[model samples]
Target: MNYIKKTDAYDIYIEPSRKTIVIRQKWKYIWSVASGLPNWSYLEKKAWHQKADNVIWLQWGSHFVFWALVHDENNSNVSLHKKEFNLEFDIQWVTTDQHWTANVKKIGASEDFGSKVNPSDKKIYLAHTDVKRRIVSNINQNTVKHEFGHTIAVNDEYGKLNGNYYDPIYVNDTKALMNVGNELRARYIRDIKIKVNKMIPGVTFATFLDK
Candidate 1:
């Protein structure tokens, strides 16, 4: 009973009129995924969103649901950091193992939506399953960004874009975010920088905060 109708590019918009489930902005939401470490603050203040309009946090169902109910006010209780950013993620969950088979599936979420402007209220739903598995840092970050790319309505199908640019190969193992010491991490940073160049022009994270 899972009906997936592809929208434009990486954007998968589910019409609320068609399905019983509806996710809207301006509401505190949650997913059912597990967060290995607390304070998903890494995403909140990061310079990663200079170009994107919306971002979604997809994970296991339990994790999503728990976070949604517990720590959404000012996104403060959720983080240990003293200074909090004006951040909120429209959380969603995958709920089953099968749902993870999409073109850019992760544990319970896909980075498959976009924001037209900074703090864009446009929504993106991350999908993930209830299944549990070990997710190391590099693997986790790759999955996170890949799906985040989807959230920005970027193409999941690599062939459509410049092969030299959005290479999925860079997301594998050493080239992943979890593999911090690897050259791929350097490459990933460069890729994000290129995206920022398009989004914010000459702005750099160094101008705002340290990494």
Candidate 2:
């Protein structure tokens, strides 16, 4: 009736006859930040991609993931490993680009564009121009989880399509994780659903609405 395939990056679910595919990721993350002296900004703008931090992997990863795994849904809307698309996740720590590697910098997006993935390389370019730090920010983690949605083919439900990124038309739509909010929806799984449907003819992803 259903088949599940696990990998280092994601778990693939396939119901061939029914043509339904659900992909849940188990992301291990390592972050690179600009920690230089007064020149942190200059270095950050230069856009240097630093190597992952080992200590961050140890502390942040364990705390965020392990705690989420043990806890129940206080509010699944903002939680990681839970989604409206029949998706869930498990995150650990790793120092590889193949994993959820982020360039946490005080440049780009954070001030405006928000976070985005480099489509060519499939790497996360997280904008940290806001908070001090949040490594171990993947899987069930809200911030990282939102960005991860992009990597696995989730689209921005915010302003991009309606107009420019500056448009506030969808600002109020931020309750969904893909938006600037904390929820997940069928549209978040749109791209992946298409890909899956292509692979297995007639596979349909059921749609759902928020409660």
Candidate 3:
């Protein structure tokens, strides 16, 4: 594996034996808002900052917020089927009740399902039931993780329009992160690959699914 790029939010590496490109994205939530008021550390809460529900600057970084990382190893490597090479997400989630980096909000149990507002939307709306057990357990449920997939730009794969978006050859795949499953498919990492290529000049990796 050859290291390609490194940033506060992610790191890139190329693994030749498996013909896979790796992206290790840091799961820290950086929340900062310029305020006329002084930075406030809410003693009542574990999260301390300038004090507000909203933030003007929110991004992924490793230094600021210290939260335990939860790994989704189920979805972090290229599949071994048909010699197909594709990108995959090796996400490291920092554990905490509050994720200032993600625009995740809790909705009522009456809601039909958890959803990411849009393809490029950073916000995620998850039903309260999906998050209740995860609060203290530190183990994220499938619903919560599925919505998290959207924040990184992976589209849904259940419908006719979406299945072809990533895993074009997949059928009723229910065990992957975006397809209401926990196991990730190869093409799910397309967006991340595109982003990486754009960031590093003279470097391009083909996503086998696109071929």
Candidate 4:
């Protein structure tokens, strides 16, 4: 079997100022105002999960809406790492939790399922309608990145460390950031391809939904 060699990867840079906005907007979109403030660390660990949600949302609304991200300041501390990875964006730097109910109310989702008033039992909960439609109606690209990344984890047999490897290594193959390594790489083009293949069967490497 031939391994999918990384291709068409490009460096991504977010001015420190814009990075914060992107993260916040994405969180706002994903968690929704109804979901209230999100845990930053939780977002860091599993941000890619937001992608499927965003795609679903786009399918439903087909409009770009503003999203605001709030962090729980009581326990918020994210690092600013060099975006040396192949990915063009980083959602790890956003961490602030000001209880803002207005945003959630604006979307008519105030009494919705994930409101702070009634947080979901699941760590990450998607609206059933959105799931049924195979779309995420209110989240953004970054949120999708955060949430989908969570699904790629597997425990190590030796119990050494929490190896959050997205791309698992094969026999005698070196670990790649797109595969199983700590650092995010500049290879999200490959990452997205992998996710799309899983989410929509029969998708080829070159196929992508129109933006």
TM-score of each: 0.23, 0.46, 0.41, 0.19
What does candidate 1's lDDT look like per residue over 30-138, in tens digits?
A: 3222444233343432322221213233321111111012223454333322221111133223333211222211232543332112114333443332122225442
For model 2, residues 1-211, the per-residue Cα lDDT tens digits are 4656554345566543433344544333334444452334545533322212222222122221111121334533233222223333333334543544555554433334355666455466655432223333231224555556666666565665435673354556756666655555555545544444343222333444333
Instruction: For candidate 4, write residues 74-172 as lDDT tens digits.
Output: 322122222111112322222343211111121233344431211222133443222222123422222222233332222111122234332333312
What TM-score number comes out for model 1? 0.23
lDDT against the true structure, per candidate, is 0.27, 0.44, 0.42, 0.27
What are the root-mean-square deviations of the candidates from the true structure over C-alphas? Answer: 17.6, 12.3, 13.2, 19.9
lDDT (10s digit) by residue, model 3, range 134-184? 322322334555554565566666555423355444547755546644565
TM-score of 4: 0.19
Residue 75 accuracy (lDDT) in model 4: 25
Query: Where in model 4 is the C-alpha error above 4 Å?
Result: 1-87, 90-159, 162-191, 195-203, 206-211
TM-score of 2: 0.46
Where does candidate 3 clash, by residue pair? 68-95, 176-181
The residue-level lDDT of candidate 2 at 209 comes to: 37
Best-to-worst ranking by TM-score: 2, 3, 1, 4
Off by over 4 Å in 1: 1-125, 128-146, 149-184, 191-211
